[model samples]
Target: MMQRFIPLGNGYSDIYELMYIGRAMPERVRHMLVLHPFDENNPEASLALVMKPTNPGNFQPIYICLEGVPIPSKRYDLWRELADELQHDVIELTVSPSGKFSDQEIFFQHLIGILRTNHYLPRLQRSF
Candidate 1:
């Protein structure tokens, strides 16, 4: 299965879209994540939803709103509500902030490693 992070903008509109996707495709939702970056002073967090891989294509998409939403806010509450509706517990993880990486892709790679290590995601299958 090929998994990729599909970034949604860091804003109110983006979060609404994320919630919409979760509500629209509740069955596809595999996991809900709250990525807390290493910077404790930072008030923002990244929200994500892992979707099951598509049939035939085997493409698994992890939708994310990157480090834009504030913690303990109405937006976060909305996310938690969505998770409850989907019957999933929000998975919280500590990670290096995106700012620590030179590029977004690198940051995503790092996140992938963490998810796999924590057993939230399956190990990558390499075609030799």
Candidate 2:
């Protein structure tokens, strides 16, 4: 399966897109994952929506707002409100800070691996 992250703005306006997508495609929405990773350098969080893949399709589109909004901070009120409104519990995971990674791509790769290992995503198959 293929996973794609669609970036959104880091403000209220951008957050609305997340809300809109969830509300508009409630059926397509499968799960929500919230990551709270922090270090001495920066404290932040990410919200990811795991939507159901299309029938017979290998693509699994994941809409995300990376550090879109300050998290674990009072600013996180918006995120809390979203979960409350959607009535979906956010699967919170504490991970290594993004700063620890050499780049954003690596950090995201680590997060995806975590999800896969935890069974959030399907594991790879091996054929002899």
TM-score for all models, in order of appearance: 0.96, 0.79
Candidate 1 regions with alpha-carbon error over 4 angstroms: none
RMSD of 1: 1.0
All candidates: CA RMSD in angstroms? 1.0, 2.6
* TM accuracy, model 2: 0.79
Residue-wise lDDT of candidate 2 within 4-39, one digit each (tens)? 666675435666788788888878877777777666
Predicted candidate 1 versus true structure: per-residue lDDT over 2-114, tens digit per residue: 99999998846799999999999999999999998889777699999999999989898999999988888999999999899899999998899999999999999999999
- Backbone clashes in candidate 1 total 0
Estimate the lDDT of model 1.
0.92
